[model samples]
Target: MLLNLAIKNFAIVSFVEIDWQQGMTTITGETGAGKSIAIDALSLCLGSRALANTVRPGCAKAELTATFDSSNISKATKWLAKHDLQQDDECIIRRIISIEGRSKAYINGSPVPLAQLKELGQLLINIHGQHDHQLLMKSQEQRRLLDEYADHQELLSSLKFYQSKWRKLNNELTLLQQNSQQRQAQLQLLQYQVKELDQFALQDNEFTQLETDYKRNSNAQQLLLLSQQCIEQLSESNNITEQSSALTQLQKSSEQLSQLAELDSAAAAIASLVNEARIQLEEASKDLNDYQQSIDIDPQKFALIEERYSFAIQLARKHKVAPEELVSFHSNIKKQLNAIANDDSRLDVINDELEQCFSQYLEIANSLHKSRTTAAQQLEQQITNSMRQLNMPDAVFKLAITEKQLNEPANHGIDEIEFLVSMNPGQPVEALAKVASGGELSRISLAIQVILAERIVTPTLIFDEVDVGISGPTAAKVGQQLHKLGHSTQVICVTHLPQVASKGHQQLFVAKLTDGKHTQTKVTELNQPGREREIARLLAGDEVTDSSLANARELLAS
Candidate 1:
């Protein structure tokens, strides 16, 4: 149940604090007295969209807070606990809207997303606006109402899951079927590319090695000539008797230095250096001779290395890749070919999965159909009885459920639901929009709300002038139904009818006051005498005559 509502700078209400009570509370005011301001404030706290215009003139922001007692509301309590927002039995929801059109929501002093606030709000209260009956004309709204009344959430969730899976698989199958010819053509191209690459058989890092081998083999003759010249200059000349080679000159110098060393110690060091140079020269000459012998000038081997290197460059150009990247490119082509080869098997798998999803969807949908069928019967009987009590003794309400076309599958299932009604005896039932007059529609809407209220577990229900098209004894009946509903849950009604106002266990009067410079709305709880005067004002306009006061007292007495 709603405990209190505090609103600041909201609409024309500068600041108002309303302490709500148990049972039915009627809010009465003149036409422009801002009776619905409280409702609008509560709606904002419940996650309704807020606009900058909702703030009072010249105000920076608007703030709204709603306090509820959630001890008996198990669903709300569980939700609070799950969200880590629980604070014992008290649940407070607050909303602040800035002039910049930004808003914030809080639950139990903890910031929350607007969606979470709305979700928790649904478990706390259900508001029925004056224009709610207008929504009943829509077929989708009719289906939703029926489903809500039947509590088919679990079945609907299962059906939705299967429907989503079925749609995914069906889309895959369609794509595969549409692209089969294109896929076949692509497969042939990829197969040819893979086979060509296989014949070339390029190995990793082989391109660099091929270049090295080709260069080395092409220069083998030049390398051999250079080695022979070095060997002849160091050790032997083309004329063997020519003692002008580097090794012969170094050996003669060493013998001369040895003889000088006996005369001076410095000459001894110079003799050792000359002997080391001769020894190094001889070893270098031997290495050059060995290298010249190892060089091969075979043209056949050089031709093979050149051909391999040239072919690798040509293949790289043909594949539009660097010479080193041909190996990876070839690997990718083989992978594409393999994927295309598996497409036929993938098509078969998708068909099987689509069939399975359809079977599951149909199973859950059928179960939901049965549940709705049963709920419709019960709802029809109850609303019919309620309508008779609301001064429509001959009204008949029915729910029509028919199958949709086989090809027209929908996420909500394959059923078309419509509300049917007949307003008079011998009048064939027709669609609600076609048969019900404005007044009759309002009464029917009220009847349905009253009946559904008995089944709903929400702690509070707010009706914002839902009795607009009703009057006289019918207005009294609407009041009685709301009052009766209050026995099980808290009911708040904003009304203009004196009969309805008289039925409330408590009454509040909304008055718009102006001080030349400012206009504001104020709500005041009415005591016995105050209630009588307010009801009189509602009955006889602003005059509040003695006769109207007597009538107000008589009505309250009943």
Candidate 2:
């Protein structure tokens, strides 16, 4: 339920604070006295669109704040908790509109998007404007009202979920069908590429090993000549040269030092060093001879290695990669080929899944259709009964449920609902917009609201002059229904009828005050005498007479 409303610098309302209560509160004023200004301010707090003109002429901005007690409203409390904006059981919604046509919204002191404010606002209050009945003309709004009256949120949610899933799967199937030829062409190209790489037969680390073998074999004769020359120089040789071989010279030097060692210790050390050098030369010569024997000069093996190395280079350049990268590149192409081969199977699987999703969607849609059909019948009867109580004895209300073609699925299911009415005894029932007059529309709108009020969970309901085209006993019936609604929830009504104003448990009078240069609107909560005078004024216009006061008292007493 709404606890309070604070508005400042909004339109001609410089400042107004209203402490609302848990029953019907009527607002009354003279014509052009800004009686609806408070409702307008409350609308801003409910996230309605704001304009720069909403700000007072001399003020920089307009501010509105509304406080609600949501301790018993689970939907509102859950929404606050879900958004992490909960402040115990009190929900404060504030809106600020700047003169530049910009606006900001806050919930529980945390800044939020305007959409969040609107979403949370719906759970807290339902406002029925004087012209809300005009919305009954639209088919979509008709469907929504019927669905809301049906109270089958679970079924609606299921239908929407399956519809979403079906749409996604259907889109995938469409794309796959459109791209079938392109996928086939891609698959062929991948197949040929994979075949070429497979024939190359490159192995990991084989490229480097092949290069080493080729280099060693290509220089076989040169290696043999160099090895033989080194061996001949290190040992004794028959070559006719003036220089003795290194091994022969070292042996001769060792013999001369050994003879001198008997007379000198230093000569003995030198002889020992010469002998070690001779031994090292002999070992080096033996190893060189062994290497020379191991060298092969086979042309067949050399030609094979050269051919393999050239082919590796050519294949690497063809693939736009180094020879060492060929193995990894071959592996990647194989994987792509395998994936392309699987697309046809994937298409079949998607088609099967799409069918399953559509089946599920149809199941839920059929259930929802049945529920709506039943609800339409029940609501038609209830609203028809309510119309009689609102003084429309001959008015007939009907809900037309037309089923669309099954192939054309909609988020709201297959039923197209519309409200039809007959206002006279001999008149055929026709669309509400085409048949009902403005006064009839007001009563119809009120009847629907009063009937739906029992099922709607919103804590507060505000009627903005909904009794505009109603009067007499019909106006009293409207007032009585509103008062009855207030028994279950909070109701604030802006009205111009004495019958309605006299029924309010509390009353507020909106008065315009001016000093010739400036005008402002003030809302004052009325006590017993004040209410009597206001209701008397509503009954008798600007002049309050004894007869009007007596009528006002009798109306209040009743």
Candidate 3:
């Protein structure tokens, strides 16, 4: 229930605070006295869009706040707890609109996004504006009303569950189908690449080793000629006798120095140096002779090595990779080929899953369609009965659910639901929007609200000027209906009719007060006598006669 409402700099309402109560609280005022200003402020607190000009003439911003007692509103309390915004049993919702067109919302002193405010607001209040009657013409709204009346939350949940699974499978199937051709083309390219890389028989370190062997073989003849010349010059050259060779000459010099060293110790050091030099020359000659014998002059083997090296370079260039990295590249292509090979099998599994999901969705949708059909019939009879009490004595209401033609499953089941009505007997039922008058529309809307009152989760219901195009016994009936609704929930109504205002357990009078240069709106709760006078004013217009006061009293007593 709403406990308090505060408004500041909102339109012509500079500052106003209203203390509200349970049951029907009717707000009455003369035309242009700002009766709707309070409701507008309430709307802003509930997350309605605000205009920059909503701020008063001299004010920089407009602010509105509503305090709700959440002790009785379990849904609201649960919502607050879910969002971590709960503050005791009291929930304060505030909205501020700046003149520069910026808006901010707060829940229990916590700043929140507008979307969150709107979501939480729905769980707290249900506002039926005068124009809400036109929603009867919308088929979507009609379907929603029937579903609410049915109260088959479990069935609705099941339907949603099936719908979700089906959509998931459907999306996967579409993706696979769209990419099937591309995947096949990629597989073919991968296979060709794997085959080409396989023919190379590439091995780690093999390319480097082969290149080394190729270079050595290609220069074998030059290496053999150079080593043979060195061996001949040092040991057994054809140009010099073996005894006259450098190695033989160094050996003779060392032997003669050794004899002199034996006679004189100073010569011993020179003799050792000569002997080490002779030993080094002999080892060098032996190394050169061994290298010359090891050289291979085979032309065919050298050509084979050269061809292999060129093939490796060509393949590496073809794949746009370095020579050493070709082995790693080959491994990658093989892995891709294996994965592509599994696509067909994976696609088969996905198709089976999709089929199962589709079957489940269809079964649940069919069941949901049956339940909605039964609920629609019961809803039509109830609303028809309500319309009679609202002054449409011979009214007839019908809910038409037609099957939708589709190649695949749809989201909201298979039926298109609409509400049809006939105002008088023997008349064919037509779309409510086309035939119902403005007054008839409001009354019909009220009747539906009354029927669904017990099922609605909102703790407060505000009827903003919904009494338009209604008066006489009809207005009285609307008032009584609102009063009945109030028995179950808090109802605040803005009205110009005394009949409706008289039924309120609490009455508030909205009036405009003006200084010479400024105007402001205020709301005052009327006492018994004050309510009587206001009702008298409503009954007798500008002048409140004695008879009008008597009539107001009688109306209130009734």
Best by lDDT: 1
lDDT, model 3, position 331: 93
Q: What is the lDDT of residue 469 in candidate 1?
A: 87
Residue 417 of model 2 has an lDDT of 87
User: Among these predicted structures, which one has the highest TM-score?
Assistant: 1
Ranking by TM-score: 1, 2, 3
As for lDDT, the candidate ahead, 1 or 3, is 1
Per-residue CA lDDT of candidate 1, range 1-558, in tens? 999999999999999999999999999988999999999899999998986579899999999999999999999999999989999899999999998888889999999999998999899999999999998999998999899889889999888888888888788889889989999999888888888889889899999999888888989988888888888788777886666888878888999999999888888988998888888888888888887888888899889889989999998999899999989999998888888778778997887787777878877888888898999999999988999998898999999998665442468887889999998999999999999888788888888888778887779999999998889999988888888888988999999999899999889899999999999999999999999999898888889899999999999998
Quote the positional error of residue 170 for candidate 1 in Å. Answer: 2.7
- Judge candidate 2 against the unseen true structure and give its global Cα lDDT, from 0 to 1: 0.88
Enumerate residue pairs that collide in model 3. none
Number of clashes in every candidate structure? Answer: 0, 0, 0
What's the lDDT for all of these models?
A: 0.89, 0.88, 0.88
Candidate 1 residue-wise lDDT at 481:
89
The residue pairs that clash in candidate 1, if any, are none
Worst 10 residues of 3 by lDDT: 236-245
Once superposed on the true structure, which residue ranges of model 3 sit more than 4 Å away at CA? Answer: 197-317, 320-352
Deviation from truth (RMSD, Å), model 3: 7.9
